[model samples]
Target: MIAVRISIVLLLLATLFGSSLYWLIGQFPGFVVISLGTTALQFTLWTGVLAVLALWLLFRILLSLIRALVLPGLHLSRNWQAKKQHKNSQLTYRGLLDLAEGRWASACKLLTKTAAGSELALINYLGAAGAAAELGNEEEVNQLLALAEKADSRNELAVALTRVRLLVGKGDYEEALPMLELLHGRHPTHPYILSLLERSYRNLQQWDQLEKLLADLRANKVLGDEALRQLEISIRAQQLTALAKNLGPDMASNKQALVDLWGRTAKSLRSVPVLIAHHAALLSQLGEPVQAEKELRRAITKGWDKELLTSYGLLGGELAAQQLKTAETWFKAQPDNPDLLLALARLCQRGELWGKARDYLEAALELDSRSEIYAELAEVMGRLGEHDKSLQFYRQGLLAVTGGETQLMVRA
Candidate 1:
């Protein structure tokens, strides 16, 4: 439109200037008004030519001025955009501060007013989601998160974090499971995403998913010794729980399903001790006590655990007897391991080896005195006809119980 306007003006100027020059020349064409004896027609013709050239040059100068004028207009437009963006940024910043201060209503208003193209818009979505979460408006939170997810997916760092958080917040662990798996499959050492995925799966009781994520973390050295130890303990607890829950009398029907699930979980865990224990525990529960015994023994040889003793005792018969022997050996190997001593005490009491059981129970109490252990020991002593010792143990157990119950009440 501007080009057309300029072109039309240039054409009009050329026509008017040419007409004026021609009129000037034609008006005095017959007069001999030459300063150096030049004919009037010659002077008129030269003057007309000069006038035409001058007008053309002048028109060009005007065109140049119009073009030069556009730079300031463009600069002003850019300045306006910058100011608008800065204002939006300020809005978002203030909104975030309000959110931190728990002023959800004010935060939401400020964030909503921010422009979308600014980084403020992204922060606005985050603030709005937080506000919604605080208000317990799940639907509003979901809506805001969905918007955030859509926007962040177009950005590199934001995509994984946003999607995982959204799925987790909604308790959709199964759906949230893939982002890390897909990313780690490509990048192999994305420590942060790996940790998030692992935690999400763990919370959902998806041991198989958790196992795979942990394997990646371990492979990348993202987990330190202490963290790895804690992870192993948690995994062990979960596997044992799964085995105990899934045990059924109809082995022929449920055995394969149990084996497949446990195996898959163990395989994904990079063959951890907990998975081995899980497989054994499941097999034992399924009536293959022999295989379960072997698995437990292997786990014991690799590391010590109280779970093996409890599980072995639950197996009963020769396996249970063998477990007792293993427990005793484990106790002897690591005498300071109070749980091992406790397991030995429990196994001995089951086997009617009353004297050895009493000895181990006392040793366990010495290591770490707890109400449950003392209670069990007192019961065993009463059975052995040592009424006096049993009463003493019972009084100690009562004190421990009182303290424990008090602590629990305080926590509650």
Candidate 2:
């Protein structure tokens, strides 16, 4: 409308000025009638042409201004869309992190709402499965893992591990074994996978496979020197037990195998007190009770472990009484050792050295008044025909118990 109005104003002014000039020309003596009419006609035609052109220019300017206003909105919309997509991507990433950190429900919600089958989505799904497993949402875990597997076959490790853990948790070792075999055969060097597989094999009592895999892991440096040595010792112990079970008490092959295992294990596993005790027990079982006795004594010198102390006396079999004499001598050197003192008290009670047992047990109780020590003392006192003292010690032992002590309490 403005363009039209401006065009009319321009056309009217051009006509008025041109007409006035034509009249002024006529008033001059030399103006011809035809010439003036032609000039006026030409002026009117040029004015209308200029008016259309001016209207077009005005319209173009308005159109350019309108585009300038609308163009920014278009760019802003695009930018907003890009930012929204980015935010969604970030939310997906955060969900994956949450899943890794065990936020199951948050992970599930994020993954379920985000784009599926993309690499990020697949990762999110995997994380959700793990989180779901932690949350005990077994059905959701299975579903998520399955979805993740469907999205990408490269997710085999994640899916398989989830399945293996679930099976292991359920004590379905038979089902878990096949998956472990597959993983071990395929990705034999994956530390995490191999670690889980080794545990599964150990649980199944598949010593031969466990030993072989443990050797591979050790060679690859997947397990540290200490861990590898410990695992090797465990494998040897398991093998020894299997051989001893199959070949019976007097089998020469069984005895020889046990001796060879113990001899090597003693050197490799010297740092691990538990494994050292195991090797000592194997030595004793293989008919080398004195050697086993020396190993336990050596271990005690290196480390103070109460479990090993208990196992040392139990490992000596028929030579237990003689081993106790040696243990007593060792205890004299480390007289204040609470575990040694306790072990001596038990040994003396077993040997029925009543006065010596009472003295040793009383000494142990004085050092550390554990319920077990009190309980043991009470039994020894009762066996020595000291009923009143026994009852009094029993009451004292009961009073010393902390919460959940009933679990540890055993009748002597």
Candidate 3:
């Protein structure tokens, strides 16, 4: 409607201008002339106006023709680009999903293909690297990691973490250590980095480093109470066990060091039965029977531990009788406890109370027919001059050791 209105108004203005131009030309009765090289032209004022209007209309037609020809190509080009972008986005999304679903091969292919054109090349390359790692393609993993590093300098932390995790998962702790340490230096409190570092330290048997890392984890509350407690047990146990492996040139100094380590341990950890038992066993091996007996008694009184009770029966010297008395007292409360009964038998055997050892062993065997109990009873029977019965017990022990599926007949 607006176009029609404008066209009608233009027609009226053209008619009025033409009439005015004709009147002016009639009054002047003159012509304008132009010469160019070998061409000459002459026009009245009215005719020149018509010529200029025709040229303007022709220019509009040419402009419309140009637009008609070029616009579709531009639109097609834009559509093609939009389609390619959409396909790339879909491939990236599916690649991420594939990674989450453990489709390593497909994920690696898709992500690598899209990485060059991806706006988030960091994500694409990192995902591809993980997929390559999962497929055990070490060379491909390295190549993808290099691409990731080159794609974005700001992705150093992410790249380092991915490499560390992959190395750790493959049991390549030796190679993972330097990277982990580097990450640790930059991000001291990052939980996942700390966890990877902890695993690396453990795999390499770097207990001192593990202990320090565990302390940091505890201080930062990165580990929960139960997890921290378990980690404390593991780290302290490893440290003590390592110490026990090499008591050093000065036995006394080494023993004092172990004592100092135990002293510095958290009281909550010290109260753990298994840890106490381990510490006691180490002390006993170091010829510190007094301290060994002290730790065993302290731990068992608070809570009975089967391993600790077993260690108690193995303590020698004047402490044997005292430990036996302690075991008997515990037995009175837990008569049906098979481990405690076995411990009593061992303590009695150490004390040279043959008949009492035989009685405890028989009673324990009645409760639980373990291979170790059968072996202990067989030795006791042999000591008591019952050779025939000793052979039978030994055969029974063999049967138990073999999952009770084998039967053996013995004759003396």
Candidate 3, 245-361: lDDT as tens digits: 888889889879887989879988888887887798888888888988987887786667787888788776678788888788888898998888888999888888988998888
* lDDT (Cα, 0-100) at 176 in candidate 2: 83
**Candidate 2 residue-wise lDDT, 60-157, digit = tens:** 99999999999999999999988877877888887787776777788778866664634476677776776677778889878888887887787678
- Winning candidate number (lDDT): 3
lDDT of 3: 0.87
Better of 2 and 3 by TM-score: 3
Off by over 4 Å in 3: 1-71, 405-412
Candidate 1: regions farther than 4 A off = 1-109, 116-120, 123-196, 210-240, 248-280, 288-315, 318-341, 353-360, 381-412
**Best model per TM-score:** 3
Please state the error at residue 130 of candidate 1 in Å: 4.6
Give model 3's clash tally: 0
What is the lDDT, from 0 to 100, of the residue 272 in candidate 1?
Answer: 58
Candidate 2 Cα misplacement greater than 4 A, ranges: 1-91, 97-103, 117-121, 131-135, 154-174, 202-208, 230-254, 263-266, 270-273, 282-291, 294-332, 398-412
